[model samples]
Structure formats: structure tokens, C-alpha cells
Target: MQICVIGCGYVGLVTAVCFAEMGNSVTCIDSNVERISMLQEGRSPIFEPGIEVLLSSNIRGGRLCFSATLDDGALRGAEVVFIAVGTPSAEDGSADISQILSVANELAHKLTQPAIVVCKSTAPVGTACRVQNILDQHCASLQRIGLHRVVSNPEFLKEGAALNDFMRPDRIVIGTDDNQAQQVMHQLYEPFVRNHDRILFMSRRAAEMTKYAANAFLATKISFINEMAAFCDEFAVDVEQVRKGIGADQRIGHHFIYAGCGYGGSCFPKDIRAILHMAGEHNRRMPILEAVEARNQEQKTWPFRALQDQLGEDLSGLTVTIWGLSFKPGTDDIRDAPSRTLIESLLIAGAQIKAFDPIAADNIKRCYPHAVKTGQLQLVDEPYDALQGADALVLVTEWKQFRQPNFSLMRSLMRNPLLLDGRNQYEPALVEREGFVYVGVGRPSTQPVAAALRAVV
Candidate 1:
């Protein structure tokens, strides 16, 4: 298939390269000439694993290419056009689909032959239909009505494992009433799901809602576990144990149930807001989702609150070390990350921050330039280096490097042996044996009974 992807962002780049890896001729188009140039050289603009190799291999095999514009003959002989542009949230919480609409309008004008336009970007309900209407109108203007078909094929790729997710999708949802479009999409995705026929055919609106509902449900699970963790903390119970107790039930299987600072990425936050906006537009109330959003916001402040509860409300002159910056490991995405919230709170409290992440430090530096310039925040090269002279160590992202460490060195290096485990990545008893005060989400620390009581009181 000759495919043209009208975006070189994470989704579009991954989709194009993966399809080309499967032997489809793919041309990924983007307005950013620099980004397109970078892709042309097999350098990924995003931090997804296993993508650059695929890009290089497929490009060498003449199955993949890139373009800066559709009018530059990128749409020539293209059978499928994917509008995989971004739909970041608006100020009112609705998905800003201006990018998708602009791409659709361009394709409608440029597509000289009949093609299947796939709405690969996540958008509000009726967005796919709206794109279809644009194409229909364009065809009507030319008296070549019904020349093109539109299909809603939302992506379900995870950030870290996007290549694997695309290569072996759990399920493929195709939304279209046109039999030709459905068949073409099935043929394109048939290779990925050869082990099973996991293609779900649904209405366009249902497909859009499915994408939003899926993210909202995952966010709800995270917020639910965080709320449970808060409750457990009040009773001196471990949320990990409670998580296991409830997760053992087959009906309530564990996934996204781990108590953490909170979830922050491109999808969950934007989708949650988008769905809530959708509900509001229809004069409906989603109180549960509203609570989920609220809980998540509070959850992001858990580490900061924990610090204040243990140390002092005013963190003046405190040297705090943060052991991660990315929202979650395996990628360098920090959109709405808990670390940001913690850093902001710490900065306002006059705490000197030392943070380290293998890949995310540079991104974090960009976020806190003043702090970096003034030496209030230091993005260190080594994890333990960040702990040098630290008053307390807070684990933010659960990177593999921070999983097992030389605790003896860490304890000796830190000004105070206080470990705030944000991801619940450490066992309290084990860390206590290492001669450090260990605190975790919904887990009691190893503070002296009197000190703990005094702090609680």
C-alpha cells in the first residue's frame, strides 16, 4: 500500500515506520522541515525505542520516505492518508483538533485520486464524520462525489513500547460505514494481528468514544488506587498490601493499580479532560471522572506533602535530591509529571533541588532554567551524584537504574538518611536495615516511634 502520514509526531512517525517495516510504501509528511530532515537521516525526533532502526532499515529498503508538505507530490498515488497530527487539550478541556482539521482540509484539496482517509489522531466525537463531510463537500464541488472514504482508526500505542504495540496490537478498532474503507484498513492491519483476528468494527462515534473511555478508565484506576493509598496511610496500612489483597480477585485484576505520585503523559491527562469536556457539551455530568481528575491532581502533590509532613512546612535551605524526572521510565516525556509539581512546591519552599534522569535531565533543565541558572536546581549526571550532601532523597520516576543501588554509599553521601519513595519502589523494612528512614506511599517509615508520633501529632 502507498500510504501518506500527515504528521511526524510520535504516533505518525511510529505508524509510518512500522508500516514501512511491514513492506508498505510510506511517506510521512510534516510541516516542520527540520523534523522531516531529522527523520530522513534515521534520527527519531521522539524518544521511543526501536524506532530509528526501523526508520533506517525501511528507508534503505525504499519502503519509507518523508516530506515537508503534501503539495510537494507526497500524496501522489497514495492509497491511504493518515491524519496523525496532535490534538492537545484546549483551555476549556476539549481536544484542540485544529491540526487534524487543517490536515484533513489539505488532503481533501490535494488528493487527486480516491483514498481512504484515516483519523489516526485522537479527537472528540463526530470529528471523523466531520472530516468525512469535508471530503464529501470537496468531491461534490468537483462533481466527483463519493470519491474518497474516511475511517476512524485511533491508535492504542503506549509511549515506551510503541514499537511493540504497533507490531503486535492487542486489538485494532476500525470505524467506518464504507465497506471498501473497512476492507482496506483490515488488509493494512492484517499482518499485525495474524495470531488472532482482533479487529473491532464500530461506528465512528463509538470508536472516538472508545479511545476517550479507554484512557479515562485507566486514569480512573490510577486515581482510585491513589485514593486507596491515602486512606491506607491514615490507618498506618501499606497500600501495596491492600493493592495485592484486592488485586488477587480475578475480576479486579491488577493494572494501573499501583499507588504512585500520579500519572502524567500526553494521553491520560488530555483524554481525561477531553472526555469531561465532551460530557459537559451534552449537558451530562460525570461526577466519578471529575473526582478521578481531582484525585490525580492531589496525588501529584503526595511527595511534596510527605516532605512537609516529615520535615518542616517551610523547606528553607533544605537540600532535597530527586532520583528521576520523567513521568515514568523508558521515555523522556514529562508532560504534567509529578516531578514538576514536586519541584515547583520545593522551589517555592526555598529547597535546593538535585534531580537526575538518564534522558530527561535536559528536558527538565529546559523547564526550570532559572533554578538551574541560580544553582537552586542541579541536573546531575549520576543518580548518587544527585544525592551528594542531600538532606533527603525522593524517588520520582522508577527508572531501572534507581531500582537497586549502593545504599551504604547513598546513606553516607546524604546529609540526612531520609528516603521518600514516591513510586513505592523500596521495601520499608529492608531500607530501615540499611540505616535510613524510609517512607513510601501508604507505607509507614522507619522513624523512631516517638518521632513518628510527634510528627503525626
Candidate 2:
């Protein structure tokens, strides 16, 4: 199959490279010249695990290529065109699908042959229909006889495990009323789902809704556990034990059950907002989702609030070490990351921050240039280097390296041995046994009453 993938961001680039690996000729198109050039040189613009290797291998095999525009020869004679652009949350909370619409309009003029345009981006329901309408109007204007087929084929790739997710998808969703479009999509994805017939053919609107519903439900699980964690705190109960207790029921298998700082990335937050906006447009209210969003907003501040409960409300001149900066481990994406909330709050209170992440330190530094220039924020190379002379340490993202550390060494390096476990990665008793005062979200504070009261007030 000759495939053209538009908007070579995370989804588009991964989709193109994986298809090429499966013996399909793929041309990935993006407007960003620098990104396209990097891809053409066998470098991935984004830091996804093993993507650069796949991109290089596919390009060397003459199965994959990159281009800056759809006007180029990329879309010519393409069997399927993927609109994998970003559908970021707008200021009004709806998905800003201008990118998808723009691509549809561009394809209307550029496509030399009728092709299936797959909506690979996660958009609100009926977005594919809108794309179809745009293409139809363009076809009528051009005096073309046939209307282009549009399919809602939302991607379900995870950030860190994107390559694996694409190569072995749990299910392949093809949303189209057109039999030809459905058949082509199934055939294109047949290789990935060869072991089992996991292709689910459905209506376009249902497919779009499935994407949002899936993310929203996962987000709700995170929020639900966090809420339970908070409730357990009043009685000094370990949420970990309760999590295990509930997870053993088989009906509630553990997936997104970790009571972390919050859920953040390109998907959960944005998709939840988009779905809420869609509900509002139809005069419907989703109160459960509303509370879920509210809890997550409050949860992201757990680390900073915990820091204040250990140190004073005014964090002036305090040195804090942060273990992770990305939204989650396995990628460098920091969009709406809980680490940002803690960093901003600490900085605002006049605290000096020393942050370290194996891959995301540079991206975090780029986000705070003025702070970096003023020496207020330090992005360190070594994780222990971040702890040097620090008053407190907060584990934000649970990177693999931060799992087990020399707590004795950490205690000796810090000015004050205050540990705030944002992701509940450390056992409070074990951390306290290392001669450090430990604070964790929804966990009992180990500080002395007077000290704890002073820090909390």
C-alpha cells in the first residue's frame, strides 16, 4: 500500500514508520521544515523509544520518506492518507481541530486519486464527518465526479510504548460506512492483528466516542484511587494496601490504579476537556467526569502542598531536588505535568530547584530559560547531583532509576532529609528508617508534631 501520513508528530511519524516496516511504502508529511528534515536524515524529532532506529531502518530500506508539504509528490497516487495532526484542547475547552480541517482542505486540492483519509488523531465525535463534508464541497467545486471516503481511525498508541502498541495493537478500529474504505483499512492493519481478528468495524461517530470514553475512564480510575488515597490519609491507612486489596478482585484489574500526583500528557487531560466541551454543547452535564477533572487538578498540587507541610509556607532560599520532570516515564513529554505545578509553586515561593530526569531535563530547561539563566532552577546531569545541599527531595515522575537509591547517601547530601514521595514510589517506613522524615500523598506524615504543625501552618 502507498500511504501518506500528514502532520508527522508523534502519531503520524510512528504510524508511517511502523507501516513502512510492514512493507507499505509510506511518505510522512509535516509543515515543520526542521522536523521533516530531521526525519529525512533518519532522526526522530520527538524522543520516543526505538523510533529513530525504526525510522532509519525503514528509510534505508526505501520504504519510508519525509516531505514538508502535501503539495509535493507524496500524496500522488496514495492509497490511504492519514490525518494524524494534533487536536489540542482550545481555550474554550473544545478540541482545536483546525489542523485536521486544514489538512482535509489541502488534500482536496492535492490528492491526484480518490483515497481513504483516516482520522488518526483523537478528535470529538463527528469530526470525520466534518472532514468528509469539507472534501465533498471541494470535489464539487473542482467538478470532480466522486466524493473521497473518510474513515475515523483514532490511534491508541501509548507514549513510551508506542512502537510496541502500534506493532501489536490490542484492537484495530475502522470506523466507516463505506465498505471499500473499511476493507482497505482492515487490509492495511491486517499484519498487526494477524494472530487474532481484532479489527472492530463500526460507525465513524462511535469510533471517535470510543477514544474519548476510553481515556476518560482511565482518568477516572486514577482520580478514584487518588480520592481513596486521600480518604485513607485521615485514618492513617496505606492506600497501597487498599489498592492491592481491590485489585485482587479480578473485576478491577490493575492498570491505571496508581495514585500518582495526577494524570497528564497529550491525551488524558486534553481528551477529557474535549469530551466535557462536547457535552456542554449538547446541554448535557457529566458530573462524574466533572469531579474526576476537579480531583486531578487538586492532586497535581499534592507534592507542593506536601513540601509546604514539611518546610514553611514561605519556601524562600530552600533548595529542593526533583527526581522527574516529564509527565510520565518512558517519554520526554511534559504537557500539563504535575512536576510543572510543583516547580512553578516552589519557584514562586522563592525556592531554588535542582531537577534531574534522564531524558527530559533539556526540555524542562527550555521551558524555564529565565529561571535557568538566573541560577534559580538547575537541570542536573546526575540524580544525586540534584540532591546536593537540597533541603527536600520530591519524586515527581517514577523513572526506573529512582526506584531504589542509596537513602543513606541521600540523607547525608541533603541539608534536611525531607522526602516527599509524589507517586508513592517509596515505602514510608523504609524511607523513615533511613533517618529521613518522609511525606507522601495520602500517607501519614512521619515528622514530629511540633515540626509538622509548623510546616503545615
Candidate 3:
């Protein structure tokens, strides 16, 4: 199949490369000349695990190409045109469909032959119908070309693990009333679903809602667990044991059940806001989701508040250490990361920070250049380096390396020997026996009187 993928961002690039790897001729189109040029040279503009190697191999094999002009290459005779452009959040929390609309107009003018335009980007419920209307209007104005079909085929790819997710999705969702569009989409994705046929065909609106619902539910789980962790802290109960007790049920699996600082990154924050906005448009109120959003925001500050209660209002001249920068492990994305909130709050209180992440230090440095310039913020090469001479340590991300570290070494390096586990990644009693004041989310601390006093006041 000849395929054209518009907007060569993370989703578009990965989808194009993966399709090309499956022997489909793919041309990734982007308006940015520099980005297209970089792709054309067999270089990836973003950092993904196996993207560069796969892209170079497919491009060299003549199955993948990059272009700035959509009309010249695969778009001319493509069987499937994927609209993978970004739909960032608008001021009202709904998606800004301007990019998708603009691309629909462009593709309408250039699409001389009949094709199926798949909405691979996460969009609102009726966005496919809107794209269809836009394309229909454009075709009518042209007076020469026939109308194309729009299919809602939202992507579920996660950053840092996108290649694997695309290659082997848990399920493939295609929502279309047109039989021809559905068949073409199935053929395009047939290779990936061969092992276990997980293609779910449904109405276009339902498919769109599925993506948003999945994200909202996952965010709800995170926020729910976080709330439970807070309650466990108040009542001197172990949140982990409580989680195990509930997660043992077949209905509630253990995934995303661990209490953490909060949920962040690209999906949960934006999708939850979009769904809430959509509910408001329909004159509906989702109080539970509203609480989920509120809890997540407050949860990000738990670590900082814990440290403040331990040390008092005067955090000036304190050297704090941070373990992770990205929202979670295995990715370099720092969008809405909890560490950013904690670091900013600590910095405002006149405290110094030494932070380290296996992958996200450079990305964090890009966002905080002034912190890097001054000695107030230090990005260390190794996790232990972050603990050197620090007064307290906070684990923002539960990376594998951070899951099991040398606690004795940590105790030896820290000046004040305070450990605040934001993710609750360690056993509190075991950590305390290593000669440090260990604090975990929902863990019973030896000295909760200070925290309780702070909460009361």
C-alpha cells in the first residue's frame, strides 16, 4: 500500500517508519523544511529507542521517504493518508482542531484520487465528521475530484515505548460507517494484528471516545491510589498492603495501582481536560473526574510539603536532592513532570537542588537554563552523585535504578540523612535501619507528629 502520513511529529514519524518496515511504501510529510531534511538524511529529529535504526534501514531499502511537498510523493496515489497532526489543548480545554482542519483542507486539494484519511491523532468525538465536512466542502469547490472517506483510527502509542506498542498493539480500533474505508484500514493494519486478531470495528464516535475514556480511566486510577495513599498516611496504614488487598481481585489488576507523586506526561493531563471540556459542552458535570484532576495536582506537592514539615518554614540554605525528572521511567519526556513542580517550589523557598535522571537531565536542563547556570541546580551524571552533600533526597520517579540503590552509601553521602520517597519505592523500616530518616507515601513514619502538626495548623 502507498501511504502518506502528515505531520511528522512523534506519532507520524513512528507510524510511517513502522508501515515502511512492514513493506508498505510510506512518505512522511511535514511543513517544517529542516525536520523533513533531517528525516531525508536518515536522521531522526526525536529520541526514540529503536526509531533511528528502523528509519535508516527502511529508507535505505527504498520503502520509506520524507517530503515537504505532499502533492509530489505518496499523497498523489496513496491508498491511505493518515492525519497524525497534533491537536493541542485550546484555552477552554477542548482540543484545538485547527491543525487537523488545515491538513484536511490541504489533503483535499491534493487528493486527486479517492483515498481513506485515517485520524491517527487523538481527537474529539465528532472530529472525523468535521474533517469529512471540511474535505467535502473543499472537493465541491474544486469541482473535479470526488469526495474521500474519513476513518477514526485513534493511536494508543506511548512515548519511549511507541515502537513496540505500534508493532504489537493490544488492539486495533477502526471506526467508520463506510465499508470501503474500514476494509482499507483493516488491510493496512492486518500485519500487526495477525498473532491475535484484536481489531475492534465500531462507530466513528465510539472509537474516538475510547481513546479519551482509556486515558481518563487510567488517570482516575492514579489519582484514586494517590488519595488512598494520603489516607493511609493519616491513619498509620501501609498503602502497599492495601493496594495488594484490592488488586488481588480479578477485576482490579495491579497496573497503575502504585501510589506516586502524581500522573503527568503528554496523555493524562491533556485528555482529562479535553473530556471535561467536552462534558461541559453537553451541559454535563463529571464530579468524580473533577476530583481526580484536583487530587493529581495536589498529589504532586506531597513530597515538598513532607520535607517542609520536617525542616520547618525556613528551607533557605538547604541542599535537596532529586532522583528523577521525567514523569515516569523509560522516557525522556518532562512535560508536566512532578519533579518540575517540586523543584520550582523548593527553589522559590531559597533551597538548592541536585537532580539526576538516567535519560531526562538534558531535557530538564533545556527547560531550566538559569538553574543550570547557577549553583542552585546541579544535574548529576549518576544517581549517587545527586546525593553527595545533600541535606535531603526526594524520589520523584521510580526508575529501575532507583528501585534498589545503596542505602548505606546514601546515608554516608547525605549531610542531614533525610529520605523522602515520593513514589514509595522502598521499604521504610529497612531504609530507616540503614541510619537515615526515611519517609514514604502512606508509610508510617517514626515521627509523624511534625507532619500532623503542620496539617492541623
> Which scores better on TM-score, 1 or 3?
1
lDDT of 1: 0.90
lDDT scores of the candidates, listed in order: 0.90, 0.90, 0.89
Writing each residue's lDDT as its tens digit, candidate 1 over 309-377 gives: 778788999999999898888888888889999999999999999999988898899988999999999
Cα RMSD (angstroms) for every candidate in the order listed? 2.0, 2.6, 2.6
TM-score of each model, in listed order: 0.97, 0.97, 0.94
Model 2 TM-score, 2 decimals: 0.97
Tell me the lDDT of model 3 at 350: 88
How high is the lDDT of residue 196 in model 1? 88
The sequence of per-residue lDDT tens digits that candidate 3 reaches over residues 1-457 is 9999998887999999999999999989999999999999999877778999999999999999998877675577898899998887789888888999999888877888888899988999999989988888888887744468999998998888899999999999999988888788888899998988899999999999999999989899999999999898886778999999999998999998889889988778888889999999999999989999999999999989989988887889999999999988878888888999998998889899999999899988988899789878889998897898898999999888888899888888999999999988888888889988988888778667557767778
Q: Where is model 3 poorest over a 10-residue stretch in terms of lDDT?
A: 446-455
Which ten contiguous residues of candidate 1 have the minimum total lDDT? 444-453
**Candidate 3, position 17, lDDT:** 95
TM-score for predicted model 1 compared with the true structure: 0.97
